[model samples]
Target chain A: MSDLNNGRYGIHGGQYVPETLMNEIHHLEECYEFYKNDKEFNDELESLLKEYAGRPSLLYYAEKMTKDLGGAKIYIKREDLNHTGSHKINNVLGQVLMAKKMGKTRVIAETGAGQHGVATATAAALLGLECEIFMGREDTERQKLNVYRMELLGAKVHAVTSGTQTLKDAVNETMREWVSRVHDTHYVLGSVMGPHPFPMIVRDFQSVISKEAREQILEKEGRLPLAVVACVGGGSNAMGMFYNFINDKEVKLIGCEAGGKGVDTFETAATMATGKLGIFHGMKSYFCQDDDGQIAPVYSISAGLDYPGVGPEHAYLRDSGRAEYVPITDDEAVEAFEYIAKTEGIICAIESAHAVAHVMKTAKNYSKDDIIIICLSGRGDKDVSAIAKYRGVDINE
Target chain B: MSRIKNAFENKKAFIGFLTAGDPSIEKTEEFIYKLIEGGADLIEIGIPFSDPIAEGPVIQSANIRSLSGGTRISHLFELVENVRKNTEIPLVFLTYINTVFKYGTEEFFKKCNESGIDGIIIPDLPFEEKAEIKESAEKYDVDIISLIAPTSEDRIKLIAKESQGFVYVVSSMGVTGMRSEIKTDLESIVESVRKYTDNPIAIGFGINSPEQAEKYSKLADGVIVGSAIVKIIEEHKEDSGKYLKEYAEKMKSAMKN
Candidate 1:
């Protein structure tokens, strides 16, 4: 166990919040402490992952894609096969179980693409807790299917209209709701952000991805991967895949951000590459803001990636030089989307396509013998129509 | 006499409230001087946070404006350090607990002491959860002022006993703002507080007019008018110091007359 009190990679984490919610955050922090050491908590979480979530998703060797690229060996960590069709299930399950153990009866969350909301609702339904999700009006419109899926899972969806009416506004609305109902409801934050314990707790839960990937890769291949790549939107999936590899100095961790047009364009979601420290949605992180501190509008082909701020941990990593962040242009991501479909028969989400695009460029630079593991975070099922529209083709046709 | 103690002995001790880094750091420093010159016996500098829940529209807007002016915890320390060069007005900090926690507890108190601040008023920190801070602040010689709301009688006594310096009696059960009429029970509340501690009771949260100041000055040891002064500064944004001086003189004269 690491002593976070000394600070994590020079990033200080603590409970910085209003007085009213201190007791609740403190209680959650204490619970995290107990669960960190308690065998029962770990055992229960492991059981849920194995039995319910279908854990240890396959590390498929994409030999065809590798041959097509004529470069390094590429393997995909199929997190898309997990419950709810994404790596988000890993965190939602852990948080929902923690909520249940705390005797909380109501769960609230914020979502952009609604994947986390659907997963949270799934967990709440399984545990018989009332669930509510706040999503930005813009996100609800863009990711209408996910919104419908959350409602279908019996979770109420609130269309947040404030701020940019995107993920940031959804986060603000959720925090406001959490403060008023701190006693009875638990706010199951989607990302590894927010005050103190949440970033730590969410990271701890999501770390199972890297923990399993390390063993699976080592067992299948004779040695460790040369690089690990994942898309960074609040960086939950990326953090999950990079946590175990952070100290492995030889292995490089790459995070792909959405370059809506280009880095110079205001319509990008590259927090680490170009953002300033500011407070938004209950946490201090790199935020895309204008000179006056007003949040600027963010654009991305994937609704999930349309956030102005990245996770504080990601900012810390970027600053400490532990992880390297790069932007994948929308055109490049679409090209990768088509390439993966044509070569590997895998249609990746535009968010995941950002990672795919990065892997393609990065693979060409490495030797043919080198290995790179790309986290295929989510399935393209939710993205098929959007991809078709972007390519000026209908899926039915 | 104790600096805070002496001020309360002769007349009601005035506690001036102004947002830190308001307009700008230079303007905030100038505002503080104007406040002290205007007969403010004590000063409460507000450290603006991004989300101020207890603040009404006026104070909330002020916070947003100040944050837009780049007022962070580090900036606040710099402001206080600079102000320490000129005056020693028993400056008390009024901020939420997050800002304190953000700058670690020990470091926060150390910086406060280094800046020559006398006390702190954190409305969010309840008595039960403040033992650690209370102990640390005692070591650092920084008095932690406690607030007693209108609802809690028994808790008020406990707060009065534990609290150092004067007790900040919230005049109403609302956020910081301005109002025309003084609440009727303000005198009774001040009288109730006097039973627990001989320390001065400062009534605040809506003392705008000099008449309200005069009325509170007659009943309580001090009258705090924040939004009124902030409004004056905002109204005369182009020449903040001049307007602040005029407003402070008006407030001080009303307290005396």
Candidate 2:
């Protein structure tokens, strides 16, 4: 119903793509509208999520962390346990299935940390669809293991060498690829960003995180958590974690942005912290740009969160006072990465460590009886080498 | 008549494109003269963007080279003003929407009007979202050009009917680049567009050769050649004027045939 309003979240989102991709995007919107209500489509997606991707990921109570923080009762939503090692599979499987239904034989995607690429490759392999992923050349160097993983899953990976050679350039290359091959190839955009239907579609698929978390928390604690926190890259995981809780006026939806060094520095990806309203990547949203409106080359230690803009929905949420976005510095996130691994023995993704870092800094502010839910969006296997190098412990992968 | 309308007067227009400051702003000025000398009816001066999604490698590289050379929107505005003093040839800007929106839409178009820019082609701003910038463009008497791609099957008439200045018919379903052959049925797309608006229709994308321009000019009122010219600039750098003039003359003469 919210999306029925032209896919806009208070004038933030719209279809701003080229004319070449307009009709294809329209067809995608139509297919999504029709299939969202069809029982067969829903049934197939449910089966795929449960059987192949492993649905209903654990909502483990972090007793050690809760006791150590000495304030809120902490619960970690273990999306990291999901197949493909991140929440990306939830949306990928849904979109890939929809692509199949729409008679698409191939799926293409852009990736940052390579989690989304790996997840998309896995789903495409399962459904027998050809898959190709575009990743920044810089990202390929940093996240080489993910490149190998995607190749092993039978997806060809292109090292994009454009602009800053990061997530933003990867997205540009993917859109270019999509425009050229829209007839048989579907762009399985791996974020709650981009033009209409994409922000809406990705959100619907990923909302499963909150749909299940809300139920599990109610069954266990019998009360809503005071705050739900998740890391914001293109803000898919955060949007999913906050979607079901949006109506609960008492619940605080908090998003942690990647502050590469600090929000005050040029080397940062804290869009909400220092961004202005601008349009790029097809959606009218807050973007980190120069005075001339050129998108800045944003930097973040976590490749996934090194984007210049946030999702349009997240922009609306930030503007409407329904949610709050805070920038977590690389130092803080790395510290939390080490802290969580030592405290709970859970080696979470560095992207997720941003959320944990926020929780670590604020959990003590809440009462002992109060509750907090942290959405661990992915596992840390891919980031171990990077984190080790960051901490002066270089271990080759 | 408006400069854009005059461009199509009794002739098949040859529209040439180049990034505003690919190597430097002065060089772009020299290149514009070369295009005019070789017989360009209209020129599209591209305002370099940080991320040009609609462009392929050729234009994308030009954008990077322009930006790295410290070209800004204000500099391009000044470029237009300087170029306007010598030539009455219609000049337009081809850029992403964010550049205009960030520069303040009203202020951007006002500057365009002052600098003598006849029109603008925003690849990212579709018909449905044109209102965001159309008012400002109209206020300044600048035509907000509409692009109808091969994929714009049902929406071609809608776009063409409301199209200002000229209708840009994207010859294929891809980013800007040179292709050996264009397989899309452009005559039919042009036919459908012809049924809606009387404005000139110029076909672009993958049109590099004079033969290709000659063939496509038969179906539409104008032929737009971008990447090919930008590629020439990319190859020759500052010494590109002679080659650009020769290429433009060849393509323009071929279209005349």
TM-score of each: 0.70, 0.99
CAPRI quality of model 1: incorrect
lDDT of 2 by residue, A40-70 (tens): 9999999989988789999999999999998
Which regions of candidate 1 fall more than 4 Å away from where they truly are? A1-3, A6-8, A277-285, A289-297, A385-397, B1-257
Best by lDDT: 2
Candidate 1, A329-365: lDDT as tens digits: 8899889988898888887777889999998887888
Interface RMSD of each: 6.4, 0.6
Candidate 2: residue A135 Cα off by (Å): 0.6
Model 1 Cα lDDT, one tens digit per residue, B1-257: 54567667677677788887778878888888887787777888888865554555576667777887777677778888888898767788887665675466788899988887788887656665475377678888888887776655556677787768888877764566887764547767777788888777888888888888888888887888788777876677647877777777787788887
- Highest-DockQ candidate: 2
- Residue A123 shift from truth in candidate 1, angstroms: 0.7
- CAPRI-style quality class for the chain A–B interface of candidate 2: high
Candidate 2 clashes between residue pairs 3 or more apart in a chain or in different chains? none
